[model samples]
Target: MSKRFSKIAAGIMMMAILVAITFTPVKAQDDNQNADLWQVYETTFKSAKYVDLTHAFSPTIAVWPGFGNATFRATTAGADLPGYINEGETYTYADHGFIATAYELPTDQYGTQLDPPGHWNEYGATISDLPATYAIRPLVVVDVHEQVAADPGYHATVADIEAWEAEHGRIPEGSVVMIRSDWHKRWSEVERFNQKPFPGVSLPALQFLHLERNILFHGHEPLDTDTTPTLEGEYWLLHNNYAQAEGVANLDQVPEAGALVAIGFAKPEGGTGGYARYIAICPPDWPNGVSVVEVPGAPLPVQPYPLRRDENGVLRPTPPES
Candidate 1:
């Protein structure tokens, strides 16, 4: 057999292993045992915690306006596989036969999905072209629940971001910012979450983060970044140069700062955005100081940032340092 084939077989075997590995974070067993506030926080925080930020997708889950519903079908089951044996009233499959399925996904935009530049720019970076590091970053939450509660179409403005900085300090240089409007609470019901009017980051907010703060990524509770298209008109902020997470939820569980988020998704070649699973990792206790502060306190070190899409819309990432 060819060396390549042998290596492939070995790799597959390693992935097929079903070893169970569980990691338990540090946590206080008893809080009422005469512990102080810090002690309680410490014990609770000692072990790290994780929160699921991805929305669950299903036939009943909400979809973008005018989009089609997802349909799942099992192509082949144990009884249908070749070499199957039939008993008196039951059926058994050969050891090699197993359940098989196929998906005719119309687009990857359904459910919780990533929005790489390719989603907008024809020559933009595709999912495969994105660096692995992009998936992980410090998590920052901007809560606009007050305004959202007042107005369903309230757009997060520059003032909102400035307020966040006022309390938490300037957003970290490479943090993944999430906008929360408490919309995730309506996830169980489709229309309430997807069809009803919602709030999201405004153009000015996106500009401040992308141009000035230089955040690693941005996310929102709604299906789209530009929620008020009639007033905002055209999703230039998302389509022009930035990649964001859409249909994200559970921001209420995350804090204003100090958490870390990791996004995992499949990379389908020649595809746009697709289903994704994003998780936020929270340390037992919030850090003593702000999660990240640079502008007023200290200047951030220079790091390679991807240059804006060229005139032709092709992304040109910076070269690695020597």
Candidate 2:
């Protein structure tokens, strides 16, 4: 009987030890999980405000050269008097009788032929049509417009990035660095946006971002990242050097940093540059990695309209002249 009691006591003691060991790890794991959750929450709740970088889209909106102008007008009448019935006299109508009314809404104009084509032949869509799969990457905004305007000699050179890094910290790896010249500021006037002389990324800048930094992609708000007049340096960077090798344009929608961008493609199948819904994903805090996918501020790309004047003292698009 004593022996039996000893065996039972030992079994009970072993069970208690096992329970204590198991419970401690479970408690520790719970504590770790709670800590992670708190970190995410704090990061999210802090970064609530988002800066809008995209210019508004409208017929009056400024566009680059070659792109069409925007236009809108009523296309159909909403109500009309009946031909068979008099207006003053009421006529009895049978049950199930029907009346028709027509109304028209204005169509949105994209731009002219001089405008940048919506899609590239290789990508099969415009920069806007980038898929959700691409959204996971980090976004970097390179002030190409401001930088170039400030210093015409400025190129995306090592010195330029080093200067920027000195001010903003290291450029995060595997991120998209957008060049913002506030070039979109010209959206309201075509000549101002496209014709205005301004310096763009120099070849050095292109090489630095592409080969040296191995940036995922580079984009600019301007029609092209390089300067106009087709300088040999610029040509070598884009066509000859193909430094961008693979990059995008019109990155005005992305924030300088701490933003996730998703480009929704039109999926035109075998077409160059399909229309896209450009979206920005910002975290709640500055940089904790929780994203709030925001809707795009710009309208979808479309064709341009003819210019016209409206009765309300507004400039509008008229039918194109033959």
Task: Judging by lDDT against the true structure, name the best candidate.
Answer: 1
* 1-322 per-residue lDDT for model 1 (tens digits): 3454344334323322311111122243242333444443343323446678887675557777677666544343434434553322232134433433334565778888888778777877777777888766778899998899999878788898888888666788888888888877777877677764777778888888888999987888778776664534125654665678888888888767656787898888866786889888665343222222212325655547744333333334556567
Which 10 successive residues of model 1 have the least lDDT summed?
16-25
The alpha-carbon RMSD values of the candidates against the true structure, listed in the order shown, are 20.3, 16.7
Per-residue error for 210 in candidate 1, Å, reads 0.5
Error of 2 at 241 (Å): 12
* Model 2 lDDT tens row, 36-128: 434443444233334433343445544443555444432232344566544433322232143322222131113211111233223223334
TM-score of each: 0.67, 0.51
Residue 203 of candidate 1: its Cα lDDT? 82
